[model samples]
Each structure stands twice: as C-alpha cells, then as structure tokens.
Target: MAPDWPAALRVYLGVIAVGNLVWEAAHLPLYTLWNTGTAQEKLFAIVHCTGGDVLIALTCLALALITVGHRDWPLRAFRAVAAVTVVLGVGYTIFSEWLNIVVRQSWAYSELMPVVPIIDTGVTPLLQWLVVPLVALWLARRTVQRNLVVTASMNR
Candidate 1:
C-alpha cells in the first residue's frame, strides 16, 4: 500500500499544533511576566521562542487543510514545504550543536553567559515536519491496504 499525502499532511499539522499548545501552555506564565536578571532573561526567551512556535502551528494547520482540500493540485507544494522545513531543522540543529561545542571548548577563555545553546532545541521540533510526509505516505498505504482487504473479503 502507498501513503496518502493529504491525510498525512493533516496528521502532521495536528501533531505540530498539539506540540505548540504544550509549549505555549508551559511557557506562557514565564513569558507573560516582567522580571529582573535571570527571571527577565527567561521571560524574554519564552516570548521569542514560544511566539514563533505559535505562528508555525497556525501556519501548519491552515496549510494542511488547504492542501487536503485542493484535490486537483500537484504534490509539489507539500513536498516543497516539507523539504524546506527539513533543511531549516537540520541546519539549525547542526549550527546549535557546533556553537555549543565551540562554547564548551573555549569555556575558560570566554565569559560565562547565562544562556546556553541546547543542541536539541534546534533539532527536535523538525520531527513534525519530517513526520508529515512519512505519515502521509503511511496513511495512504494503509488506506489502500484496507480497501484491498475489504474487497477481497467481499469476494470471498
């Protein structure tokens, strides 16, 4: 069985939406406040990072719905979006990891910054992007398999 592009896209979007919800819900308290020193820094981090994630979640949801509804369009749009996300995710992940390594290596010479670069921060959320296409393909295949099984059973 082959994967279905539309269904998978929807699932990917759903996953992203849920993930963003979690992120926003968890960080909102920290972001919405004004504080000094480390508290202020964390507040800023929550605002910048979680705000961007909310936008991504919205975009994914809308785009998924649009792609699913447009039955006549080619798959190129979905593929392009997925590929771009992958590239961005991979690039960010590598750059973040590299920065961490550099910081750690020069720890003695450099001033200790309150903020540290987390490798996974840049790498992990891309899972939803990657899953979109893969899951879409899987869904398509499953649908096909189910149809085949049902058809076979009917004949029997």
Candidate 2:
C-alpha cells in the first residue's frame, strides 16, 4: 500500500517542532550571554532561531524524501533522512555563514563560540542541522511506523 504523505508530514512537523525546541533550549545560554539584549530582543531571537531551524529541517526532510524515496518502513525512510541531513547541513552551514556573517554582516559570532575549521560557521549551528534533524526524523519515522502497524492490526 502507498504511504500517507499527509500523515507523515504531520509527524515530521511535530518532530521538528520538538527537536527545534530542545536545540534552542540547549543553546539558550550561548545566545543570551552573547546578545546582551532586552527581553523583547531575546524573544525575537528565540523566534528567529526557531523559525530558521524549522525551515532548514523541512528543507532537509523534503530533500531526503526526494532522494531516497519515502517508504512505508521506518528504516528505509531513515536512510534518506540521515543522508540529506549531513549533505544539506554542511552545504547550508557554509553558504549561510558566508552570506550572513562574511557578506551581509547581519550577525556576529562571539569569540566564545567554537567555529568550524574552514567554513567558519559556529559549531552549534552546524550541529543543530546535523543532529537535531536526525533525531526529529527518527522520531517522525517511528511515529509513522507505529501508526501503520496499528492500522494494519485494525484491518486484520
């Protein structure tokens, strides 16, 4: 049977939301200490981070689905998720770092933050794409698999 794309997408989004929240929470101190801004500014920063993370997660997921062919099985789907995360994570990190930091000067990284050797993006942001999305994708795949199992059992 064909997979339910809508249901899978919902699961993916939920996973991304939770994953992004955790990612932001983990790096909260870094951002707060680095910014030295007002409460409203901090709130905006949080919102911006969350929004951008979600966009990256969604784009990676879409690319993965396209590359590996989304399947009903969790394991199969995970291959795509993992592959795309690494590929896009590295690529986007480089491009975004160059664009935002080098070119536009939109944001500046603190000296405290560790930078990737060549790309110059912060370690946290790079890992944010690589690690967070994998976790989110895994959770989403598990959810979809569980639902499929439940539906199959119900039909039997």
TM-scores, all candidates, are 0.34, 0.82
User: Residue-wise lDDT of candidate 2 within 83-123, one digit each (tens)?
Assistant: 76668866887798679888998767766778877777788
Off by over 4 Å in 2: 31-33, 70-77
Local accuracy of candidate 1 as per-residue lDDT tens digits, 24-56: 345334322322336666556556655565455
Clashes of 2: 0
Model 2: per-residue Cα lDDT at residue 65: 70
Highest TM-score among the candidates is held by which one?
A: 2
Best candidate according to lDDT: 2
Candidate 2 residue pairs in backbone clash: none
Model 2: per-residue Cα lDDT at residue 14: 78
